[model samples]
Target: MPKVSSVIVPYAVYLRVYEPLAAFPEPERTHWARYARRPDLPSYQDELRRSLAGLLPTPPVAAPVQESGDAFVTEVDGVLCVCPWRTRLRGWLALAELDEELPRPVLEAALPEVVRLQAAQDHERWLESNPDARPWIRMAVWQVPLHWFVLVSDEERAYEKGTGEVAPVLRYRTPMVQARRRVARSLRTLKDSMDEGPLVEGLLDVGRWLEEFHPRSLVELDYGGLVHVLPAGDLEDDHSARDVAEGIEALRTGDGAAAGEAYARLVERWRSVRDRRSAN
Candidate 1:
């Protein structure tokens, strides 16, 4: 097995608050219109820099907006930008160089403050008027630098007045979990194919990497904006990690035939799933 070093997993917390333009009073609406303009304008970037200053320990590295309105705009490092639109204030903060153990408390504490600064008064007033709005805050965590696969999890929370806190009320999807299921299924398929090659070796490599993490490690995917566009079924996960480990172990014991068989099983399983889905 290859040595696993201390890897710095890049993580990001995406925060978004949605409110209609009509909900805002006249003066505030005008103010936002100027704030949420095209990124090419020097004034727009400056405004974001000023608003977010000192909000996070690491300042945003200025970069061009990646997309149009309502899209996530960010820099290469820890810097974050709120891509404001007529209806929403959406952005993400990249928490660079996080350890495998994700610090949930630190994230929880900083989120509200960031929202308070970025959303300004709009978030509060929206809640005041809508009162019944479900899950006022939408947050997602992204585990970065995913080369071959990705995993995504969504958490919904409600704000409490007395404590000024956001409590998680629901967590429905975990892409990583689903990926595990697929990997199990793929292993079953590979059982029949039995051809040894680079693909099998690559799967073994992934398994080795996953084995390096602590058992309780939280594996997340960085879906970013694709959460809005991609179908839940289309995303991938880290499910094959264990099986690859098993195959590698067989190879280490000098059982070339056994290693080849393991690879075959994975290949067949994945192919079957793809064919079945395509037929559907």
Candidate 2:
């Protein structure tokens, strides 16, 4: 069997409502400021590097190398980072030294079937197994030449205590909200850049795949790390997979005007949220 490695690369867009922090009394303000100034936040490239570093056999010594397409293949330290770009997000598939490198042809032939087989149960199993982890949010998974990659968000949820009451704590960071905005933006961009081609068809196929899930089921883009770069917005807004499904359909039908309008709405909303953050 091929060696499989599972790693969590931190999402690049960390959306938090920090306005309340400004209202804090003296010492509290000082304490929060310390955290705000921390330098450890991961950039998109940094997240890829970190994920590869953890799964690779040796530490990478050089920057990642881009390939003919949006994919980037690099053999650094002792492992290979097969990073592929999907829409705005980047999927990271780190291959260890010992794992046989599946040829591109083989991967292309096998991945679609593998994705279909796994998609049905992966999220359900993950949630059931990790009871203490954040609740299952949206995720995008993808398969590269040698490995399968996933960009997921299990956002914080209310915890029930022994008294059978849920905690009232508000979850400030909404990864799912940002995820929806990102998908919307990606679909619009994809529609704008391509005509009726394989790429466009592939994305439409993904949209159909999402439609296969139950209404309440969480949908994943399944493009490995490539989905991570999609635009994220304020956590207060609610977004669902259906929104993405509609966007895909619009794009497929050459409804560029409608797609553009949706993208404009997302951009305007997120911009307002950012402006508020700046004001705070």
Candidate 3:
């Protein structure tokens, strides 16, 4: 049995693309190359700790003044792959999404109206100048999005039953081409079986996001810190991608019972993790 610890970590999952160093233009490619060779590069956990610390100020620093210089770097077959920490832009996007979803009073309590407005205007201006920009990372709170599971498989899943300050981790990494192919096939199957709904829309959005990256880039699905909130059994039994694949196949085969069963298992498993948010 995997030993569960009381380590505290953020309850967020991230989908990130690590593009090859060659995919970048000169100066950036040069910069990342040097950064990757540095001996003191921050680990993923270290970066998360620093980011959380930044939110401890009086009003809370929602975003930084400039883009982050750090990146999550990995080596693939001797080639350097860098996923830049575009925290500033990601912050703006997060705020915008929150603003749309939350009530005014609730949103303002965390982010003052003035601060929120300023960030919105800044993002608008920034968008006008850099229309081609796309985020290197996307995050979800509480539970991983079902669409994300489409890009990975059970065999690719990696688990680390972390000890001490380290929390348990679950993630998957697949080449961009495979990820895109899976998304496309899944989208077609879902659309053909059902009407236009959230699943179809979500898959379309994911497909579009994947299209913005390099053909040879690597896609990752990190459970982030949510693993800490789940029970040991849940973590051990998690084969979300496999379940998702089963559901899709069942749908294609017109097997309603099997499809419903797979969908229920996926939803109920994540629902338990999400429901902890309101527990006293």
Candidate 4:
């Protein structure tokens, strides 16, 4: 990979699942177990830098056609867990969406139509061969999606204040079983209490995503570099998961006013955060 800039953080939030080493098959399981003890494990910043570099070639490729060998590693109660960085697959998925959404001229400047078409074809071929493939990580560029909050709770939140060159960090981690249960509950609450709409649909999607992972995996919601732009106070007091939970409970009890207040706070907080994109 090319040398990256000194910038330590990227403005994106990630929802990742780290599966226990035992979840993988033979050789792969041994690979990650040994990989866990390596001194030169890649950092999230390094992963972001590597991805940025991939876009620099002419007719920029959004993702490589080959699968990535890297992963995000973590430990749970002294047990190793790994989240493979499916960069190529994610790139194909993203490129396909961009191609559909952006006008021909605008997209051509960054990614020519032919390149996009080829990536799309490659992705289709991948799906044909590996029908069960699923991404372990989901990212949102500026602000985290509201439904992601349902998988966690305020009690799980962790905040690490930045010092010197280090960037501030905010995240939440929970067991996959817990995340799946909460998503199921949230979806039931929304479906029973309200009309079918985006919120219910989104939670359903999250539920499906969680189902793809090992039941022993861990789910995480990392604020990524967004903490750098937010005020220290905001990072300190943010309880979006709690807010989401309260809103759902309010709906369950038919407290429309309370639910509206909680939902309003969440929208306003994220709106301010999303507005930072324009400021940049």
Best by TM-score: 4
Candidate with best lDDT: 4
Tens digits of per-residue lDDT, candidate 4, 1-280, equal: 3325666666878999999988899998988787777777776777777777777988687778578888989989988899998888878767757856678788888787788788888888889988888888888778888899999999999999988877788999999999999998888889889898888888888899889888999999999867878999988878999999999999999999999999999998888887888888
Q: Which stretches of candidate 2 lie over 4 Å from their true place?
A: 1-9, 12-194, 197-233, 238-257, 268-280
Q: Is candidate 2 or candidate 4 better by TM-score?
A: 4
Measured against the true structure, the TM-scores of the candidates, in listed sequence, are: 0.24, 0.25, 0.93, 0.94
- Give the least accurate 10-residue stretch of model 2, judged by summed lDDT: 143-152
Judged by whole-model lDDT over C-alpha atoms, candidate 2 comes out at: 0.34
Error of 1 at 34 (Å): 23
**Clash number for each model:** 9, 14, 0, 0
Per-residue lDDT of 251 in model 4: 97
Model 1's lDDT to the true fold? Answer: 0.36
Q: Kindly list the per-residue Cα lDDT of model 3 for residues 62-101, writing each as its tens digit.
A: 6777888889999878889999988888888888798677
Against the true structure, candidate 3 reaches a TM-score of 0.93
For all candidates in order, the CA lDDT equals: 0.36, 0.34, 0.85, 0.86
What stretches of model 4 exceed 4 Å from their correct place?
A: 1-5, 100-104
Give candidate 4's error at residue 32 in angstroms: 1.1
Weakest ten-residue segment in model 1 by summed lDDT: 162-171
Query: Roughly what TM-score does model 1 have, to 2 decimal places?
Result: 0.24
